[model samples]
Target: MNHFPPLRLLVTFEALSRHGSMRDAAARLNVTQPAVSQAIKALEDYIGVRLIDRSVRPSRMTEEGELLARAVREGLGRISATLEDIRAMQTDADRQITVACTLGVATYWLMPRLSGFYDRHPEITVNVQAPASDLPVLSPGVDIALRYGTGGWREGINGKLFDEIVCPVGSPDLVARLMEDGVDLDTAPLIHVRNPHNQHWAGWEDYLAVKGITRPRSSGQSFNNYVQAMQAVIDGRGLMLGWRSITERAVLEGTLTEWPNGTHDLGTAYYVSTGVDPSKDALLFTQWLREEAT
Candidate 1:
């Protein structure tokens, strides 16, 4: 290994930090779990200190690991952002389609279905940017914007993707505990996400009112990012509001479970917006998205 260990190790560590567990990192990186383990071990040996604390299930990082992970995340993010800008500078005739969306939608909804689209249309190059919230605007460089809202963007043709449903969800353990203890929703250690960018989203108060629950949210913590908030829910820290498109896959995977009979559909749906005159690739991508939605 050279002066900084292989770039692969750093990349793997970033994925691990983002995804939380080895199996998840492997799924995100499209590699085997053993391979992820080996990459971390190699990087730890090169750095001459332990990066991962394997004592706990799902293996969290140590302080040293957090330092390196933070640096690597920021560094890689800058590099990726620069590359996107460079890609945007390319000519339109090059036929690369750039789609703008939020990180949660990219991670949960689009990513899982992307491989299928790529497999069918290998010639099309898709560049996805998740720099903002659910209602991503169509900038000069963006061809398509997948936004979450009631749908009436003045600039483009807006088509609905899926209706939004919000509800309380927590780890499978928490679900079992609540069921066993016969606990009510108002008293749980609710996980709150305070995303200032997404004011359209409903909170516990709104959700509780719709359900006719008079009790206030007694105990909880707040996170600025949805990712960290969801992580807390998965770790059994508390119940957080879950969206159908965003949280259904994790629920299906058995990591999180919906609170027993606790769900309400918000009147918003995700929509794909594009200019009046769309490109070939952009049209194809939107069509594929619609097909996926159906």
Candidate 2:
């Protein structure tokens, strides 16, 4: 029998190491802070080494901890991939494909035009998984992913979709209300997108600074996902930093309007990568997506 700690304990420790905070790790694992601590202690007892250095303010992993953490990440990743391969064998061939992307892209962008693909090929079922991060790992079951970056993901075959452009956008009513009320744009209530991987998505600070408009970072609602933030904007709650890939359709449809400031051409672009061996349906969907972008 394997004498290592329980898999759950190792999983919890991995989360804690990844987040660098017990509370944040617990949040990711859906457990309490004390539970995280207990799990770490249990793992330490099993491994006979202190995984965490409690002396640090943010509680970092010790050298021994780093070694174990690396091993766990790699081991779990391999195990997960093997399980996915087994599941795929049980599943019907070429009937199902999964696409992974951020919630905003899935909601405002891809979901709007998904029916077109289905109309052409009704046999394939596209499973869209919109996780919190724009750059999520393309695990076993996921056939493809749409990520925003400089196109160097070795996980699969990747290609650039298009260069990204971002700007301030809001509902027509909200802009009109702010104008009528003579509210200062800088101090006005605005939407903010907060994420652990903040670099992937541009925020108000980057937008305002590029436009030479100084503004306070603290304003209106802050949502962890753009789906909620954009919804808040549609409800006229506040204006949000918007990107072409996610907000262009909404603006063109008159559901949203761009503010006076010009757009920012983020040198980086969005990219799409596919699994090692994608199904014919997956390839068709990818080709359709590429043609649509042009």
Candidate 3:
């Protein structure tokens, strides 16, 4: 390996790039502004390139400086992430299972039913993670994942949770008004959920096409996630495609009303998948999930 700048100097430079001002970086690192400037100078001397362009009022990064800053930022980020993962793996090994699922499933389906699991196995803890992608996969540090689709996943041991039944649902008032007006699916204000990661799920176009109905040029409001769309539906904004696992409880509780004639089987189902080397605790929780789904 070649000679490199000190870790402290690189850290200071990284802070300077992030905060965009020596004073701010100094305050963040709990040091004087002159100390921040000195660290940047030391880093530049070691790298043999002008990192900060002090010619400007606020002190901007040169082209090389920008490139170095990006590298440092990514490098430090990865290091921090890896360290956290390592610590989690060490501490979370005993009696803990990390389950990843979509936000909709986590919020509406899994969370409402977790009390039973805890009741049965008080010694074990289940950690639920809802990734921003809205799609859950068996990833590192994640013991199990609840995935929704027609089962073709080749990653780990897969178990069927339940077959997905997607139906259009709306508030009770909206459903009553629409029914009274004799408004069918074609003319009703339909809330749509669309996101890049939601490809596994059905959208308005798919649902309409399946029912042989054509949506008009003007459509309803669009949201990126199910939570927001469901909120709109609850508020009587429009109808939304509701999955059986997510909306069944709400429907039963009268929070939302489903159109009996609008139900469709999209041939998709939810599956619980475990990592290649799943922990015993993960298997235990997976069994509970199967029992609940059944």
Candidate 4:
């Protein structure tokens, strides 16, 4: 028989070590400070060493405590990762392929055309997850990802999805209103999409600099994702750099209008990236995506 302290105690200790305060750890764990302190004390007693020095304003881990904490953190992280792998396996067992993509491409571009894929391949289902800011990990469950970039993703076979050309886009009514108000295109507020990974996607400066237009104005509302940025433009908030492949449907529907003749290549393209040994379904999906884009 094996006897061990509760995993909760290790978790509590790890949280306490990370946050440096019982209250903060408690808040994170959704437990009382006393509970966190008791867990730490119990863990210390089990190890037969003073795990943390509680004398300071924010408690500091002793040398022994740091070593133990590091082991516990690594162990817990591995356990969590293993459990996620198991879950992913289960998800795959259900014959579903998961995809990660940006909201702009998913909502404005992919979703509208997904019915055709479903109709053609009814045996396979797709699960789409779009994290607001962070890129999704290409793991066992996620068969493929459509990422917006310069095709520079590591650890994957990348294929071009489509070239994205960004130019000023706004609602026709909003453009008319701006024109009526005498807001010069140079001085108009630019809606910036704040993508941390691709800062060039944010504004006219990079786009225009590449095209030899050096004096594009830079000031306005910024959003973290495409959905919010496009929404703001749709709501007459301001003019935003729009990708035609993603925003074309809206443009055709008259909800958005492209400014200055509607075309300028942003020098970047979306790519379909996959981990090593992608399944047959994943390959088929990738092929379908390429065909659809073209």
Candidate 5:
């Protein structure tokens, strides 16, 4: 519907105009002088304009060529500017990130502290995903993963967020009742978290084994994830192994109570993982996370 010279012809003409010589334009465009001359000839034929004054010694642009050069320079400059604006918009879109973590960690730890991140970086939006498998993986579309482990993940750039401290926790009322009844820590009804995808998680058996106490498997009830287990513990159903990072707020708020002398260092910590070529927004978020953990 519209008639226009080939973009290559226009580009060659522009280069020739800017450099004032076909040889210089060829060097700038990495083309032979003949190719540059041919492109200009093609453009001239297409536009029916004598753009170059061959009568000059070094070959100069004619009056009409000077006008076309101005239009071409302005058009190309605007195109470059619009391209940069599109790139900026793409960078802004990248500010929205997806973080993977356990349900309990998302519910208790990350969600509560996210307000601080939003306050610091209003432009960044964090989308938290709790994997069905308690372990978080840096899968495709996942920007960052808040993983709990001893920190040897082969996935991405891994950094320990903070040390993990485990302890027995129950509802305040249940804890009070158990203490009043003089129930031993090991003998308390334990709430267990178990799943096929669960790796590196300390269960009731592992915790009891660490304390040199053995209990029957029937001594506790099991849940697929920490969220359900924590709710049951809060409802005074039983005591669950609580990670300090996840349950510290609940204990502080008096919704949950920790047993005295129950804390243990399991030699594990929460780590943040991001792809090697992380986006600027992802780097900002990880930095914020490290600051928060500190």
Candidate 6:
């Protein structure tokens, strides 16, 4: 019979050892300190050995702890990488094209352009998944990702789709309501998008600065995607700094109106990224994406 510590216990042990404190490890794993300590205790009990030197002020690793921790870290890292590789292989074998994108681009941009692809490639079926910012690595199911950010991803081909321009947008009725309520542009509730990238474009601050309006009274609410933000505007929730490509159609349709003529060209651009060996379907889909975006 094989005897081994549970993977969960091993992960906890590895985290605790590396961080050298139950509190820190708990924070890293988004769990309580007591939970982390319990995991450590379980791991030690399973191994029938003390892995940590808790007597020390800051906590230290015993000789056995050190060796186990190293092995666990290396083993977990390899397993994670291997899982990703296997997923990519499965994606390739499925002959399906998976696209990862921001909600705004998916709803506003891609949805409108999808018919063109369907018309041209009847044999290929494509799937679209949106707002995958929290994903650490592209999953095996994802074949291509249409990401908006600075160019140069660590592990995929990055292609620029279009430049982004931010400008305030709202419905005509909402703007009228704000005006009637004596709410100025600077004091309007600003809707923000909570993007996956930590570094994001500044909306109200940049808009006010260019207009020479300082210290505007503002309340900010965030959405996970541009589509949601636009919906809020349509629903009379608040005004948002809208991306031009995603908002232009709405503006033309009179569903949304652009507020303030000033537009800031955000340096970041949209990209279509793929794994090292993308399937032929993914390649074709990417080619179609590039042709459409350009």
Off by over 4 Å in 1: 1-93, 215-218
Error of 4 at 82 (Å): 20
Please give each candidate's TM-score: 0.67, 0.65, 0.69, 0.62, 0.67, 0.59
> Which residue pairs collide in model 2, if any?
none
Q: Can you write out model 1's per-residue Cα lDDT over 97-165, one digit (the tens) per residue?
A: 888988888888998999988997887888989875556888898999999889988998888988888
Question: Cα miss at 13, model 2 (Å)?
Answer: 49
Off by over 4 Å in 4: 1-94, 134-137, 177-183, 195-202, 208-218
Tens-place lDDT per residue, model 5, 1-294, is 168888899899889989988889999999999999899999999989899999969778899999999999999989989999899878877678999998888999999999999999998889999988777898998999999889888878999999999999999999999999999866898898888888568887788889888779778889888888888999999999999988999999999999888999999999999999999999999999999899
- Point out where model 3 deviates above 4 Å: 1-92
TM-score winner among the candidates? 3
- Using lDDT as the yardstick, the better of models 1 and 2 is 1
Better of 4 and 5 by lDDT: 5
Write model 6 residue lDDT over 1-294, tens digit each, in one string.
269868889888888877878888999999999999899888888889998888987778899999998999999999999999899777755666778776667889998999999899876778888744523235677888877668777887667877877778888898778778888766787787766563455556676787787764446788866667888989888888787878978989999888756477768677778888888888888888888877
Against the reference, the lDDT scores of all candidates come to 0.86, 0.84, 0.90, 0.81, 0.90, 0.79
lDDT score for candidate 3 against the true structure: 0.90
Please give, for residues 1-294, the per-residue lDDT of candidate 4 as tens digits. Answer: 165778888899989878878899999999998999889999989878899887975678999999988998898999999999999778767577889887777898888989999999988888888766546557656889887768777788888888877778898988887778887656777788776765545466765566565453546787777788888999988888888766789989999988756477757788899988888888888989999989
The 10 consecutive residues of candidate 3 with the worst lDDT sum are 193-202
C-alpha lDDT (0 to 100) for residue 20 of candidate 3: 87
Rate residue 279 of model 6 by lDDT: 81
